[model samples]
Target chain A: MRNQLPLIIVFATGLLVIVTFFIPHEPFGSLEQRFLVWYSIVAGFTMLLGLDSLVRYHLIKIRDRRSGWGYSLVLLSGLFVTLILGFYSWARYQSPFKLGSPFMYLYSYVIIPLQATMFALLAFFIASAAYRAFRARTTAATLLLVSAVLVMLGRVPLGGWLWQKIVSLIDLLPGTNLSGLKGLEVFARISDWIMDVPQTAAKRGIYIGIVLGGIAMSLRIILGIERSYTSGS
Target chain B: MIVNIIGTWIAAGLTIAILSFLYKDNPLYKFAEHLYVGVSAGFGVIYVWAFDLKPMLIDRFIENQGVERWILLVPAVLGLLMLSRWFGKIGYLSRLPLAFTVGIGAGLGITASIQGFLLPQIQATLLPLTTINNIILVVGVITTILYFYFSRDFKGPFKYLLELGIIFIMVSFGASFGYTVMARISLLIGRIFFLLSDWLRII
Candidate 1:
């Protein structure tokens, strides 16, 4: 009974939502909105769960005197301070002395730079990973190496000069011609074609199957038939 | 004038602190990293409550007295139920919220699949192949798809053909990467220009 109930619920709700998309009526139009509201509520509650986990984990680390407990303390203290300030600010509404006033300063000076730094780390990681992957030991690797070098060159001002030289040389061939305008136009056209055609087509096929599967899954949940998310059954 | 000067100084100081990690890990970077995470999380929660829940839930339920105010009860119950996870015996109650979340997520995924993925892809592929450039695209598509076909055993000539397909894909990917790198480099250059010209007023 436990298993059957949830499964039925999921299939039913999933099917309704999918059908709702096509119907576009008073209730159907509101279906997505209702789901969003539900999502917001659930997300808010889940955040408390996340906070509990964070606090518990750090507390354990501190108790155990784990490596970097000092950092953890700093983290917990910051979290508490921020939470107090946030709630205080919200309660006071437009109060000039609200704790949340310092938040913008903290974000501008601290958070943005950290995010930028993390992204910057990607460049070094990519270089290292590419170096290992692009070894020219086989036919495939050799092709990769050549393409990488060409693309790297083609993107820069130096690449433009090189392309011009190559185009002029090709033009010199008997009864054959390649103008700079023609070359540039052809390159741009090819690039756009590559992005729009095969890439888009491949992504589309994967997406369709995913949608159908999701519908089936959601239907299983909303109808109270997919109670696997609950305990016991 | 004072605010502008202070802002410039803060920017320069933070930039230096972040850049210091590129040379080696330091206490300054660690401090900034922790402070960043803490402040960001705090601000994010506030924004969520103010922008999302305030107008959507609290205002509707309390101030406006909307008919759908009763809908707030459903989530409010679920939210209270979730707190039951803190207790050993009632922890199972938390599953109610989890199930609802998964269901909604699944519905969204189903909708997004049709809109975001399938239609655009089919349209893209079925586009005109009459032009010379389009013919190249058609060849690239067919060959690349063949290259990915894993079920059939590929012999010598077929292997060679697949290799050619792989080369085309690699070239395309490399070009994309090169473009991305150029963008990042340009951004870095822009920042340096700002520091020199606007901040210092010495360009």
Candidate 2:
């Protein structure tokens, strides 16, 4: 009954939503919105399950005196403190995310800086990888390298200045008539063309395939062929 | 004024701590990382509660009247039922809410894919191939799509098309990587600016 009931609910809910997509009538349209709202609420509550798992994991580490348990303690302390502050703000101001709230302060100062600097660290790694790994070994590799270089250069002001300098040097030649041409912005134009045409094609093709695959997977889920969600401890 | 100054200093310290990760996996970076995870998770919890539950469920339940008010009990019950995971024997009951969400997700996914992505992309791809750019775009898209079509091995001409498709894909990847690097560099620049100007008052 437990299994079958859920499957039935899945089929019913899935079918209703799918059917209502085609029939955007009075009740069906509003019903879909209501269902979405309900789903959002339910999803919000589901987040507690994740929080439980996180807290439990940290607690287990602390209990076991595991390696990096100190860090886990730090993590838990940060979490609990933030949560306490948030709830306090909620109680006091009726909004946890209110401007000038302590929660907002934490978010702005601690979270924003930590997140930004964390991602910024990747820039060094990417540059290092580009230096070591990016070689023009073959036709495909050469294309990739050239495209990357063009994009990297063209995205900034340096590419334009370099292009202009080169154009000026060429115009210094005996027979060159580069006066009629736009010199500085040529690199950017080429980069834009590459992004707009070939890049768009590649992305569009991949997106189409992904969307088609998603539809198939969604169908499988709705039909109960995909049952992995039912299996857990 | 004092609070803001204190906040800026704290932010600067955290920024430097995170940037210290570039040096090595030291204690400072580890502290920052763990704290970041905890604070982010806590923030997420508060965000979901404030944005989703409070406004959508609790507020609506309170503000509405008659049948509308009571209708919210359905989701509230389902949400409570999800807590059945904590119990051993009745843990399977949690599948109901999971199934409900999954079904809704699947239904939404299918419709959204068709309506939002698939049709629009296909329509956009069907462009008039008058210019060189258009031709390249049309051919690039076709060859890229054909490259993924693995039903049978192409003998002669289609193989070259597949190779061409790969070239386009590689270029796309390269362009994407370049853009990502630019973004990261910009972020790094922002951090430097913050350190120099906001923290040290140099710039």
**Which lDDT tens digits does candidate 2 get at residues B16-70?**
9999888899999999999999999999999999899999998898899999999
Q: Which residue ranges in model 2 land beyond 4 Å of their true spot?
A: A179-183
TM-score between predicted and true chain B, model 1: 0.80
DockQ of each: 0.38, 0.81
User: Docking quality tier of candidate 1?
Assistant: acceptable
Cα misplacement distance, residue B110 of candidate 1 (Å):
2.7
Q: How accurate locally is residue B128 in candidate 1, as Cα lDDT from 0 to 100? A: 83
**TM-score (all chains, Cα) for each model:** 0.77, 0.97
TM-score of 2: 0.97
Model 1, stretches more than 4 Å misplaced? A1-9, A81-101, A142-158, A161-233, B1-11, B63-66, B138-169, B183-203
Position A223, candidate 1: lDDT: 60
**Deviation in Å, model 1, residue A224 alpha carbon:** 10
Q: Provide chain B TM-scores across all predictions.
A: 0.80, 0.96
Top of the candidates by lDDT: 2
